[model samples]
Target: MQEISYKQKVLKEAKRQGIISCWFFLANFAASFLIAVYKAFTQPHTLKQLQNLELIDSVITNLTTLAATIYIWLAIKKLADIYDTDVYEIFIKAVIAVVLAIFLLLALGLEGITPGAVKAVSYVLVGIGIYFFILWFKLNFALAKITNNKLFKTYVFFAIISAVVGGAIKTLAMFGFFEGGVYMLAAALSIAILYVLPTAFYLYAWTMIKEE
Candidate 1:
């Protein structure tokens, strides 16, 4: 009975991850498409004009964080439950991570918000988000190492690439590397990276859990 119950939980988590993965992809695609369209219609969009529509960017961030968090947690749960490892602390971390990620996103969404100024406790939130982001990445990479699965490793490889390209483009854009039509290209690249990360992570996890 206990064994069967364990299997059921694993299966449940696997199915949940699958559903969430699809949603993440759709939400990401919609957000990116909307942003690109918005940029196209307003070629000469200024800081204010761009920032005004930042609300859309904020929504995208929220969706990204939410989907990413749940997807990570589902993976953690599957690994812990199946191997009878203690999942209590990791569950708590997952909650904290998800909340912080979403909160940072809300900061991004508001009309006046900027990376430099999130108003109150801004540094605190950003600090937490950065730490959690690194920690989460490490944990995931550790999982990939343990699984030694080709798919998981591939996901890891591409995730690194996505982060590099995304981060580089953002930095360049800050220095005006992306402007005019070039900015639109950057927008497309950003959306593509966003879509790919969760797709890779979720598919790898889903495959692992399903075969478990």
Candidate 2:
């Protein structure tokens, strides 16, 4: 039996991880699009029912993201071990930030929480979200340099555009700038294009990595 070099090991893991990531993203994106379209087309009699559906969708998306984050961290850790790079540290921090954000969001649902406290939590969550994006961009940039894969760079570009557009839509929705149906439809389109593009690029980028 012959021992493969670390590059081969990393590529094998990446291919496996890429398939998993691709499936997760596809599931998440499809679910989100379907729910948004349903909400846009049909009106539920009760607000609670609508809210419940949205909550379920959000939970599924967040769970998928968490799982993907862990897988990405593990893959990068292996690469870092082989290359003696520090990008895995960013993954560790990103994972921690995401978990903390999720926990804080859940805490916001507790009864008897003051409005001020809620506002503060929201601010913290926003900050954490921004930091996570920065870390994510840095991690991808580092991987792009390490692997010389333009797909990673392409992901970064589309990710930034997605973030900006999604953020704008959310902000406008908060201000009641659009009707419910309009907002949901717009959000669905945003998720379809913005979210799917980056994930697709990421998956393809993993496939592009090969040993020299």
Candidate 3:
């Protein structure tokens, strides 16, 4: 009975995390769009206003990302405990590494270090992103197995597809295969699909867990 209760708690946490994650993506996208619009229409005399708009966009994205990260960490920790897995340990290490990497980049920027060091940080960030993808894939795979919900496994493929499609569209646009408006529409749709599909699968996985 205790195990069942704990599992239910984790499922609820996972569901809440999924919703927050979706909001993070959507809010960031909206913020970016607004910034772009502001830049396009703002007069040169409004330089301060443009700077403020960008600052607000940055703050919104950062706060939502932080909130999503916290919930994600909590859900992963609880799920790891229930499943007797150490994936959460990897997550903890990755979080630390990311913080250190960011700090190093900021310090280098302030010290006017060579661009090489900045490039190195960019590489580190890419590696950290891959670590996150691996962790996400493994966790969802485990959930798929335990809940017998194959929807959980589909998110990984959707994520890959979105990346590929988005890249292809951007490349084609660069070569004039698409008009500006067409490229923008395609980009927006791809991003929307990317965030929405994985979130839908995550929510469905939680529903399966609830049914179990």
Point to the candidate with the largest TM-score. Answer: 2
Model 2 local distance difference test score: 0.78
lDDT of 3 by residue, 119-210 (tens): 88788777877776776677667667755668778867777786787677767667887665676676566555555555565555555555
lDDT of each: 0.66, 0.78, 0.69
- For model 1, the local distance difference test gives 0.66
Clashes of each: 0, 0, 0
Alpha-carbon deviation at 30 in model 2, angstroms: 0.8
**What residue pairs clash in candidate 1, if any at all?**
none
**How many backbone overlaps does candidate 2 show?**
0
- Give the Å error, residue 9, model 2: 2.9
* Alpha-carbon RMSD, candidate 2: 3.5
Residue runs of model 1 more than 4 Å from their true location after superposition: 1-9, 12-19, 42-75, 86-88, 98-123, 145-150, 194-198, 208-212
RMSD values, in order shown: 5.5, 3.5, 3.3
Writing each residue's lDDT as its tens digit, candidate 2 over 57-172 gives 99989888767766776678777866656788988898899889989999999999999999999999999999998998898888888777777878888778877887787777
lDDT of 3: 0.69
